[model samples]
Target chain A: MTETPSTGQPPEFPRPTAGPPEPTRPAAGPPETPRPTAGPSQPTRPTAGPPEPSGRSSARPSQPSPRSSGASPAPDSQSSPGPSGRSSARPSLFTPAPGAAPVGRMLLAQTLFEIRLLLRNGEQLLLTAAIPVVLLWLLTAAPVFDTGDYERVDFLVPGILALCVMSTAFTSLAIATAYERRYGALKRLAASPLPRWTLLLAKALTVLVVEALQVVLVGGLGLALGWRPSGSPLAVIVLLVAGTLAFAGLGLLMAGTLRAEATLAAANLVYLLLLVLGGVVIPLSGFPSGVRTVLELTPTGALADGLRSVLADGAGLPWGSVAVLAVWAVAGLAAAARWFRWD
Target chain B: MPPCDTRGMSTAPAVEITSLVKRYDAVTAVDGLSLRVAAGTLTAVLGPNGAGKTTTVEICEGFRRPDAGSVRVLGLDPWRDGAGLRPRVGVMLQEGAGFYPGARPVELLSHLARLHADPLDVPMLVARLGLESVARGRTPLRRLSGGERQRIAFAAALVGRPELVFLDEPTAGLDPQARRATWQLLDELRAAGVTVVLTTHLIDEAERLADQVVIIDAGRVLAEGTPQELTSGVSDDVIRFGGPPRLDVASLRAALPDGSSVKEVAPGSYEVAAVVDPRLLATLTSWCAANDILAEGLQVGHRSLEDVYLELIGAAAERTAP
Candidate 1:
């Protein structure tokens, strides 16, 4: 409990620099020591010995004293290094080797903290998990729209899964990150030993974890609604990973560059547009050929088409759509890294 | 908490700045400011608001770049060697400006601790800062009081066992108890050979805690020395005594030596500014006795750090005014 001494409540510590040791407490009070101001000798450096009374008038006489109170402006405080037990030669008294934790451990710890934050936030849960589930139920069970010759549940599940990835990886991430930037958290981390790249990687991993739960929730809801999925498990996972990377990169770029309020407004707007125009709830076949060609080039459109062809039609690998998403992933991540601002 | 490279640093300053100049748009925030902080001692950059205190410290922390000057922290260029220094230095930005509103104290501290090679125990730090209640709560940081938020920022900064630390206004807006606790922790850190450089607007904070105080105003250093040197250099220690509220000031001025100024600064609080000697002391007391008054609480010390600060700031402002 030697370390416990400093951890005690602060009331015992005197303001003057002289109260360094536990024994100095008695000297800090008024009764034991005579006022230095009362005599000519009082002007001698009050930087040593007992703590002086804290008053504006007495401040000069009571200013920092060497190791008596543990600090002095004498510029030689380093020579003493008086707290005991350790050689003064070592670079740091706090640790034998002062440096950051191994990168993997740091990543793991930060990811856990991020997951806790996401799980606790009602809004984040609704957007990343609940909203997608609600969309699946409404589009299929409600009989709201004609989803083509295929079963309604079958046509909508893959598109809804794509929407789920977009929500978790992009919209939620961008808004959260924007606010973190606005609040000085990014700047604070920038100053810490944790590299900025590690922070970004950790955020991506957290998104992936949440996205997995999302797939389970939305897919489970789809299965209950009489939807039958077709597709290689490996191909489905690869498409999901590519979409997450693309969306996450763009989300982080907006958060690191834009104002939090602006990011909030813009992220929601982009989400709604992608849901309608990217063939999530609306079939891409309904658009004119020229318009469909452009929509197919968008990140959301590429992900939806890839997921739909693989799951709804069992059409196997869709190289063109996968290539589009990979391009977006590389380009989006590079742009984000180049332009991101910490504050 | 001694610096990572202590060799040859016995004489080397922990921080060295020369003619640093920084401007944002048209406003020159720091203009040709130069300073040196000796290793393992606490240096307080004391100034009034807008004195460029934050800007100067920010440059040292490598968060902001100085346009015209060079800054070296622990013998490494702060800008180019920032990553290398991160493990050895801790920085607390002003006012805890962006504590994640959604975070609680323990969660944030634990997260920051994980980023460092070694950190203090989270529970001990929480207890040391008197933040145990908030640490365990699920409440968001934004919902806490300003002082609580400040403590949280402080804990995060210190959790990483850094050899040196830069704290900006560490105790501003803190309640009295919390403020004292912060001061105590700083004292202990210095005792362990950790160097502390902080910026503050409170003159007492500098005088009480700093081994060296740098008084700045309008982006320039007006005075630099120990609190004693700054207060004592203006004159010999002042002669303060207590007597009647309205004693004859005009008559007393005439009785004192040619260079002395006499004033009753407050009711029954008399102060005499002069080259104090046995002769001057006798004359004042004899004069008081003849006037049928007792010089109670007679003391000899110069003015407080506040007076020196105000005098310097006022002069600086006047010189800069059109």
Candidate 2:
């Protein structure tokens, strides 16, 4: 029996493109079979309508105008016919059909899906939510550490928030993207009808979504435990957004230039290093004077210091820290744009 | 005519590569290669590992920049206009290429749907790829079988109804059934007038699917022709004279005429690579009759694609061998 409807498109067959050599895209004509699009808000279903026929051998009787421009199926004796029994010509699925207009909306949709996938993963959920809680419990319960004049919760909460942003944007995002490049998902997407920016933006958006979830979970947990932010909630929101964007940029920068293994190693190594150097677990004042100066300018350090100041001392937003974080974000984003590889 | 006007279509070929050279450190991945993929045709690139098939495909996909050489996909430079060109080109990479764990087929396809103006139906795509059984499943992508994940990936690739597609060995690890299904899907795609460029080492896949085959070895083009054309020129009719007796190449060659040549094909047989006209067959039979040489298990047929591929690969290996 034939594989697809008897269309006049060229024969498209399977060829493994990236890794593991499992043939993914079959060379078939564009089977624009008018499927049903999923709902828009659920983040799980497709935006297009659902397709007709679930079985492999449904016979489509309508004979549209056959466009016989490309390579038709060869007259090979071994080539099987389509299910329709009409000349046994199966439509090639790999053939490119025309798409109308630009690819922005498509990109946005992809970004949201990335977010949904990240959210649903158990490991990701633990990293985003449980990790911050565990760190808070560990840091606060330890008797050896001194809290200076402020409450231990006040000093630690802001730092943990900053840490949450960094984990989601940089460490987690790096691993995910690196693996994607390794697996050929990125390469395949590069070949699809999606725009490049859409891919990047989708990734960024996914990070943002997870960050939003982290904020709600961590922030709510902090507030319930009698910890109060000294600064305006609005200012804290700004810090969270900026910090997320900065870390996301850096994450992508690492994912784009390095091999998946390298990205994973470097991302985790840099993340842990920043945690210690940037005063997430320990205050920067405890470090030597020379090292303190260097650490103060890092995005992670600046973010932690600025967040602690606002959340503990009721201080206004720190323009210096904001500028440093913004610069890092822009620089990392530019680098990713220039060098990212999908496969 | 203008730089791109021919028969109301672009005069410049849909894809144009000029002395494409790509290198990694000291290794020359692709060396001064050039090719043309006319719009609306299926072109297959055939090569073994490290033969620069991927490097060439990536250059066309706009994911990697070449060390040297210019590439144009759909009259637009891939490197300079990656975002602009991506919407028109569809790519299906090798299996396990990349997957977001915890993603279902619908979720992934819908996400890609937002990237295009005219995307196919998600359920329809799921059904077409035989992903309906798992459509409602919540398992992460890492849990899906290789074949199932590939189907999801395929759905994602076709979501936008792309104008051009790049398939890098699209069916390497599939079972016979999945491979057949994939082939059918590809046939459906070609009927819609999509231009496809695929790479594979499986000679049979290329032979069955490709209208034109571009054979590559050592980062260069070895030959380019229709599969039939490439196989038809093999001068020798491969004769596998199998019995209880073993033969050597020198003895077999000596047994034939002065112009005839023979080479060992397997342990018990030799292939006579010479023109086998009816007169020669008669003369051979007459000679065998005189010598009491029984030509049992004698078979004659045109060379298959595997023969051509093996010959090309063998020659390349010999040239590269120390």
Candidate 3:
């Protein structure tokens, strides 16, 4: 509403005319259609390995007139090459014929598109980026909880990183996907050439991309605040990846199975509950032994605990935490695949 | 032109549905419907609301499973070979059902184009569909007007240049210009050797665009052919006039052609149904003249496609009425 209705290309756009509702017969109709000069070539940006085999359908002997206007749909040189793409010669993308793009390119495009959308949304950015960074600064700036041996920076960094992962992979993804399903976006996508499962794959990839950026920002702040420790870089990646898979699997499960409003409420509630009780901002050791035992088993608690062990404790790898994440990852993914409905 | 019948088509049809039957628990939506959409031709599934048009098309799009029947799209089973066929087929679901609410038209469409190997140029499509004005706006698709959203859906349906596209009411809420533009785009799709299967209740749309028109009622084909064949196929043309009701009907019937039937279809409305010609029309007027009846409004015409459709469905409804 804020933007004025600027006529960017009035000449190019076919404005509504005050004409009769009579359908223009295809055989003979007004020939005033000014063919808009098709601007330029859409470069086939090969995002992945190579161009696909897109040669099943013979390139339409290019429409002669494509018949212009009214009854004739104007066909230009840039029309799609229908039917053949995807399983054919993938290396010859230089003069890409019209057809189905490689599955890899499609997945990559969708992933990037999704990532841009996620980053652009003020709410998603708040949950995934702002909240975690703000939480990191707050806990590090003033020691809210007493830690006997560790500095606040040392204890809060790993835990807040876990918080960032959960916020993105579970809450943000679940809410967005639930809405997309509600709006029939997923159902529409199911009709496209991209397999439905690849959409879920793209979400997982988007989470990892966002999580990497979170690491740089939050981890840099922790370092600036005089935090120093060490853990195997590979171990950190493994933990984060496993945590992502587990959370993403559960996120899609909730999104695909629950109604949009239900997913929205449930995802936010679970995130808040875990943020308080899963040892992200609070220490599990301070609680009763019985409570701590149950907390350690939760995926959120397991991820945080494992991250803390690796970074703050300088451990090689937390196999127990990995085991818990693995179990959740497998079960959640299996269930999502089994019960997810596109409509 | 008289549309070629299925028996005349030498090549394999693009979409062939055989004895499709779909049931929703106890209510059968599609009951033994069989149809053949010839390759590279536009076919309109014309029907009233709740005539199982959506159900039949949805099953063809692989969204719903038919309880009984087989569907082949481009020589592949729609459900089992969905992955293989999806790349070659485009679908625009009813009421703009398949679009994400918050996504912009350009971004979503570009993403879809990438999924296909050779897609129509995105910017070109936008301009072609007359969506340039709203294309760059920050508003999500959900906030745009229904016509704009419909244009985007139309763009999505054609982006991949699929061999066969299913459009479920592609022009429901469009203005005349937009509707005409949509019809043009469909024509262009057909020109490119793509098969188009669209469902609409608009009589003129089917009459103007479809090479094959299938009149469906109660989930079955009542009559189907080119608009010419369908309208001209009925044996008798109706001669109708507004006159005083219930006046000497036997005398009128006896005076007209031997096979002609006359009746007062409504109060003060009479129709002489027969093989109408100038003489027959003249004879009916003379008969009215002789009876001292002033035919208020006299008209002669063959049944239009709409007339055939309404009458066929009315008959079907009576037979199936509870």
Candidate 4:
């Protein structure tokens, strides 16, 4: 490739400004010749010539004589509009036109990348997917969870599913985002042209994708152990979506406000607390009568109970649980938006 | 390229700040500072640490909001028009500002490239920055050497083909070779008529690359001029030599030209400040010979940007010291 020649020059003292007597353009002009072929067709084409460089560095000795002849053809092509075959016909070099892909494509790319990162992190995978499946199997076999009225698998499956959604959406996302903020990853993205909402949506989408995998894995294992889900399809879908939105919103709220280590400790602590008292592992029915109402109002309790009613009892849409989740989702998201700090 | 009118007008300076003041709780980071960067020129903001250089640049990049001042980048307020301005501007933050520790160089660069209107060719940029070997590998960004990480950050900043690019300490930890490569790239950017502003603590970097240098200290601008203009402001030439301590300055001054001044700044080192010409040099040597004193390691040169920088910051520090 013609570009390779430019790359071969010694990078040291490459500019003429370093008290070197040699003409700077002799070093710069040859490499710049290949830029048009490399750049997208635009107004930048006209300025890709020797005169352009001289104009900017007028303080430097203008010595375009020796190398200008050798480099003339490159700018010649750039100056003559649309004459070169590649000039007018090529697609945009950088951004898609408005109403083209824009945010959708960027969001999709960010989501895919986020998923890749989540999958690559062994700890994230274990927490979001593996731990839930392992718990589902272990809990169903335990005699302590035997409630006498229903099969143990019937109760444990939906609870673990709710736990999985919370893990992926809240614990894992909060920790990751907090660390990203500490590392300036979020700040860097903020400086870019990507819309802020697209980044948030991409994170939500990543959580959803991971949660889907968790459902398939844990649900498949439940099926193997003779657990039957009797919920209406629409209710299960609504519960899963609402659960994810609520937990992820809470996760971001914490991550965006707290320091990374604090977020890490707090997220794991909340995860464990909800897994026990929020009815994911221990049913809310067993709790004392007074706090049971309050516990049911908590996001985790609402999600687990909602999932249980739909998936185990074959119930219609649990509007009470749905309403609770909607409140948490709206409140958590609003808080996060108000207080989020990229740095 | 000519500065594109992404905001429907192209005549504004690439960056303009008027009476910018930024305070962090009890400390003022930037105080009543104003600067204007002309379009299609390379300007370097030179300052010591804690001089508010980074804070000023961040405001221009729309990353920070100044407490009380106006900042216009390419005819648009950077904060109000960030969405519109970001596409046309590129920023390389200091301290490896926002890279994922686990991301490979190519993955991170391409992800950033998709965010702009007309990004440069990614592979070509990678090659240009001499990141081919690292880009081909899967080593995470945190695992790469400091210089390598810096190069990737630099590439990310330039990949957008922006009309105005802001670089913060672009060559802080780079080796000599890598530093030179970065200078070459800045030159090319200027040739393309892209307005470039860089903040650095290195005086030589500002001297070599900047068309205009603004020396800032203690949250305010100390001086602003071309390197030559700043260096020439103090004296036309500084003559140095190693000689006897406690020289007779009275006799030397009497023998030398009317404007020439001599001082023994160190134990055995002497410096003479004057508009040095052949006659001045002859008079000094003749005076030294007649005094039976030997001048060794004699050298004549103009004041460097570093000398002026130190003097400016030193004076500022003394004034601010309680």
lDDT measured at residue B96 in model 4 versus the true structure, 0 to 100: 59
What is the DockQ ranking, best to worst?
1, 2, 3, 4
Candidate 3 C-alpha lDDT tens digits along A7-109: 1112212221111111222222122111001001012113111211121011111111112222433333213523222122221111112366887887898
Overall lDDT per candidate, in order of appearance: 0.77, 0.67, 0.76, 0.76
lDDT per residue for candidate 1 within B71-136, as digits (tens), equals 999898878898898878888888876566688878788888888877888987776566888888
The number of the candidate with the highest DockQ is: 1
**Of models 3 and 4, which has the larger TM-score?**
4
- Writing each residue's lDDT as its tens digit, candidate 4 over A193-292 gives 8888898889888888888888889989999999999969889989989988899889999999999999999999999988888888787888898989
Query: In candidate 2, which residue ranges exceed 4 Å CA deviation?
Result: A1-96, A100-104, A134-144, A265-278, A281-298, A323-342, B1-13, B67-70, B131-137, B145-155, B233-238, B244-259, B274-297, B315-322
Better of 1 and 4 by TM-score: 4
Q: TM-score per model for chain B alone?
A: 0.89, 0.88, 0.88, 0.92
Quick one: best lDDT, which candidate? Answer: 1
Pairs of colliding residues, candidate 1: A17-A69, A18-A69, A19-A69, A47-A65, A73-B211, A93-B1, A99-B117, A183-B98
The 10-residue segment of model 4 chain A with minimum total lDDT is: A1-10
lDDT of 4: 0.76
Candidate 3 stretches greater than 4 Å from native: A1-98, A147-149, B1-10, B240-272, B279-298
Query: Against the true structure, whose TM-score is highest?
Result: 4
Question: What are the TM-scores, per candidate, against the unseen true structure?
Answer: 0.81, 0.75, 0.80, 0.81
Worst 10 residues of 3 chain B by lDDT: B1-10
